[model samples]
Target: MKILALNGSPRMKASSTYHILAPFLAGMKAAGAEVELIHIRRLNLEVCIGCYTCWARTPGVCIHDDSMADVLQKFNTADMVIFGTPLYHFSMSGIMKTFIDRLLPRFEPWLIPHPHVPGVTGHPERVQKPYKMFLVSPGGFPEFEHFDSLVATFKQMARMENWEYTGEILRPGAEPLSRRSLQNLFTGYYTLLRQAGEELIRDGRISDNLQLQLREDLFPGGKEVFYQLAEGYWTEQMDKFKVPQEQRHTVPLLAKDLDSTPMAPAGSNITNDTSKTGDRYYVSNEVIMQTMTAMYDTKAAPNLQATIQFQIIPPKIDFDPGEAMWYLEINGARCDLHQGKTAIPTLSITTPYEVWYDIGIGNVDALEAFTNGDYEATGSQKLLNDMLHLFPRPEPGSDDPLAAELDTLMMGMPTAFNPEAAKGTNAVIQFILSGKGGGLYFLNIAEGKCTVQRGAAKNPTMTIHCPAETWLAISTGKLDGHQAFMQEKYRVSGDMAILLKFNTMFDTHTN
Candidate 1:
């Protein structure tokens, strides 16, 4: 069998989308199938101008003379066509979409009932030989909803072309799993995705079980750990580029208006006593339970099912030892926060409460704590990682008024809200942050100007809701907003078209 994999990511070598395909391609090659990998961005392809030239003037060919013409031939000759892309705006990337559009020439303009299948639905009839269609996409988010539109488009395309829909591989949390330490965690996933390819080559289709596994969260460590790791990455990037906190948050509407930046967030007032000795803000059992109940967003991780037991040691803990032992069970969409223990829990973690407190407040380095014998996991490390978000850190420092006002502190930062991207646009965008430190804010932009307000919009064009920590991470370039949206960390309901201005509206890096 001959396979053509068209990679649409512009990142090229740095793309996590491309990397996931490595094992799959290797599996196919090992199975004795000839595979050709092509990066679409590398080709000099022109966007389709919606002209009927391809259909009316010259059939089976786009009007523009570009490298896509050769790509078209390869696509036609391949026994199977694999569309590989990084999910963008709940769909394929612009380059890949354009490639799909250009392929319109290979089908008749008029629609009819699918020739091969007897269905009431009508689709553009294919003029060339049929080839099985498969999609390999990696979404940054952990939610399956991110692939909703992309999956629909591909399935429809397959039906329209009268080709069998082989299956898809939608790997969420692609970035987090790509981390060096976490790469080993995906050893089974890598083997499975590659095995999927082998199955395709040998059986002419991918296994259903493997397809389901591909769509599972690539980083089972959950969103909290993922965000922490992401933040470290963004911090490094900021330092590498020497991006000032002011500019990092500034969204210049006009290049000329760079000097008129908004006021940035103030520095933290709580000073850290570097000395690791302190039981002043010691975390109690109640605090842990309240924090979990307040912060856990069932919508963000709807299908995460696991039972975790926390075993706290004495001296480090102030609460009753019996109360210190807690169990958190997340079944389906419900989370049952139970105090005490379970007979056969999915996972158990034993640690000093002091170390746990420090880890919670970002004071203790988890790896170091583990290395220093502060904590130990008696069950699956993966489960412990997945449940880490349930124990979010309290605001840094003592539980004082200043700690509660951390969200407001972040509000003062230059949010990089580019009004220029909305130069000829007008919209009211609402930001509803949940969790312990969340708040509601709105950005009203029109006529190349933006007004930031502390309350909700009366009639908003779009409303984005997420945990406060997630937004903070995105603002700092530690977590990508696009990725967050895909991962279900944030849900957007309203005019999604306005979000397309994200990149054009703000420069993520400093000059």
Candidate 2:
């Protein structure tokens, strides 16, 4: 069987449409079907002028001399034609519509009763030949309903032209298919597409079950998640190119070109005490209060209520004088910051401003500082320990664990995997750790088994980003994963629901 596949995406090979189409064509080729793929954007086809010259004057020949003549000849001889396009405005792309219009020479001008329908009238085929038509489209939206109109149009076209409509391969939320970071997550989906192609060639039709599986959601998060990621990608492109605010609407920027530009080096604000100057580096009382407010995790101690007071002695400096006092009131899931001391405080910490600042910014560990008598505390010993988990530190300190330690922890994850919890799970979870012992690692989980890989994954069901120390602390049971996540100690992208399952799915204690 000879197949002609015309790709209508302007992005050509970089398009999500091609991402799905390529695998299907590969499957057809593997099944011994002769397949020829062509990009419609590369053709020099002219628009139809509605001259009716092909019907009355030339008969089976168009007036305009362009690439369409060659395409028409190939179309006439092929046993099957696959129209591959990216959805635009709930319909086929402009170039695809133009390409279809130029095929008027293949049909006669005389109207006749439709062969497939009872009351519909259509034009007769100029050259009688049995062929199959298939639609291959990928849309950015996550809903399958978005492709309904486009699919209906193609079905109607197949009926009018006296051709068999051999199903369609529709992918919703397909933007990620073209993204390099997300390719690994779609490995199973691509394999299914290939199988569909092989079945079509060998059995003359794709099974209904296969078609239903092809239309499954590309990303499990659905429409809201897709919109957020798509908007973020475009916003990142604009920022990468430094597109001016006034010209944002007028200027067109391509992420591919902008990615080549060198990025500015990231700088750190944390400095040693010796570098502190009255005009430059002193941490103000306001900064401490704001940091406390931002780091407070209400979910950490939702039921327990308490009041914590801080008595911060100011550093001896000419610009600022005297001590600073602040207190926090925690009630259920709410935390409020107030100036001055609170009456009947559950916990009271009195420390020099410099030492407390060091602990707050992750320069020194709080437990070490407390052990060395750097601070005086008069309160519940339980509250003191709970405070660390209640308001988790926002960043990792200067002393980060080594890469070997992280490797040891990652290696043990597979052994700790609970097959019962992961019975129905098939996913790739990527961990991107930064600072000191930071590197890329991913877990491939399938059929109740888990494998660890040390490089980037082509596709990942979810991605987690955090400092090496943070991950180490979480892995060793020193930190609460959910509390750290709520406190913004780590960031995550992709399926958040999967992250919530970590506790039950893996035994961190054994790791």
Cα-based TM-score, every candidate: 0.46, 0.48
**In candidate 1, what are the lDDT values of residues 1-511, reduced to their tens digit?**
8999988888765677777787898899999999999998999888889887877778666789999888888888998888989999899998898888777677667667656668655646445676888888888776778899999999987776677888888877677544665677788888987898899899987877877777666555677877777789879866765535633322222323112222211331222223444443444655544334434556546655566577766443233423678876665566667777665455666766555555644445555555555576555454454444543433333354433454554454236656656578788776665544555566777777766765335566877656667776776577877877777777666788877775576555211
Off by over 4 Å in 2: 244-511
Root mean square deviation (Cα) for candidate 2: 26.9
Best by TM-score: 2
Q: After superposition, how far is residue 475 of candidate 2 from its true place, in Å?
A: 88
Candidate 2 per-residue lDDT over residues 1-511, each given as its tens digit:
9999989999999999899889999999999999999999999989999999999999989999999999998999999999998999999999999999999999889988887777999888888899899999998788889999999999988887878999898887888899988898989999999999999999988998998888777767777777888999999877765635642321122222122122111331212233354332244665565455544665677675677778887675544533488877777676777777665566678776776765664456676667666777765556776777776653332244466778778867899899899889888887766545655567998999999875445567887766677888998888888888888788776788788777788998312
In model 1, where is the ten-residue run with the lowest total lDDT? 256-265
Error at 457, model 1, angstroms: 63
Number of clashing pairs, model 1?
10
Task: Provide the lDDT at 174 for model 2.
Answer: 81
